[model samples]
Target: MLKFIKGNLESIDGVAVYPIISLLIFFIFFAALFWWVFTAKKDHIKEVSNIPLELSENETNDKNDLPL
Candidate 1:
C-alpha cells in the first residue's frame, strides 16, 4: 500500500499539497457548522425537534374519523 501511494504521489503533481489543503478546508467547514449549531438560538432547535411529534391538522382529522 505504501509503495502504491508513493508511485501515485510521484506521478501526480502537487498531490500531497492537495490533500493537505482539502483536509484544511473540510476542517474549517465542519468547525464553523459545529459552532453555529451549538451557539445559535436554542429555540430554533427545540421548534424543529418538536415538529415530528406535533400533530398536524390532517393528522388530527384522521384520528377523529377513526371508528371507536
Candidate 2:
C-alpha cells in the first residue's frame, strides 16, 4: 500500500513543494497562536476565564427568583 501511494506521488510534478508548504502553514499558525497567548491582556484573560462562573451564578440567581 505504501509503495503504491509513493509511486503515484512520485509521478506528480511539484509534489515535493506540498510538504514544505504544509509545514510552513502549520508553523505560522502555531507561531501566531503563541504570540497571541503571550501578548494578550491579563484583564481580558481574567474576564474570559470568569465567564463560566458568571453564567452559573446568574443561572442560580434566576432559579431562586422563579415562582415556587
Candidate 3:
C-alpha cells in the first residue's frame, strides 16, 4: 500500500514541493502558537480564566446581551 501510494505521488509533476510546503505551513503554525502562548499577558490569562464565572454576572445584569 505504501509503495503504491509513493509510486502514484512520484508520477505527478511538482509533487515534491507539496510535502515541503506542507511541512513549512505546519511548522509555522506551531511556531506562532508557541510564541503566542509564551507572550500572552498574565492579566489577560487571568481574565480569560474567569470567563465562566463572568457569564453569570452578565446573565443577571443583561439577559438580552449576546451569549459571548
Candidate 4:
C-alpha cells in the first residue's frame, strides 16, 4: 500500500498540494456555515427549529386516536 501511494504521488504533479488546498476549502466552508448558524438572527433560527414540531403535531392530530 505504501509503495502504491508513493508511486501514484510521483506520477501526479502537485498532488500533495491538492489535498492541502481541498482541506483548506472544506475547513473554510464549515467555518462559514458554523458562523452563520450561530450568529444568524434569533427569529430565523426559532422559525427553522419550529418547522419539524409543527409538521409532526399536525400529522399526529390528523390521525385517529386508538382506544385504551
When summed lDDT is taken over every stretch of 10 residues in candidate 3, the lowest stretch is 52-61
Tens digits of lDDT, candidate 2, 1-68: 99999999999999999999999999999999999999999999999999876657778899999998
Model 3, which residues run further than 4 Å from truth? Answer: 55-68
TM-score quality measure for candidate 1: 0.78
Candidate 2 local Cα displacement, residue 12, angstroms: 0.2
Question: What digit string (tens of lDDT, one per residue) describes model 1 on residues 1-68?
Answer: 99998987899877779889999999999999999988989899899999999999999999999999
lDDT of 3 by residue, 1-68 (tens): 99999999988999889889999999999999999999999999999999877667656778776486
Q: Estimate each model's TM-score.
A: 0.78, 0.84, 0.72, 0.68
Q: Considering every candidate listed, which one attains the maximal TM-score? A: 2
Candidates ranked by lDDT: 2, 1, 3, 4
**What ranges in model 2 sit over 4 Å off?**
56-58, 65-68
lDDT of 2: 0.95
Among residues 3 or more apart in sequence or in different chains, the pairs in candidate 2 whose N, CA or C atoms overlap within 3 Å are none
Steric clash pairs (candidate 3): none
Report how far residue 14 has shifted in candidate 3, in Å: 1.3
Residue-wise lDDT of candidate 4 within 14-57, one digit each (tens)? 77898899999999999999999888999998998998767576
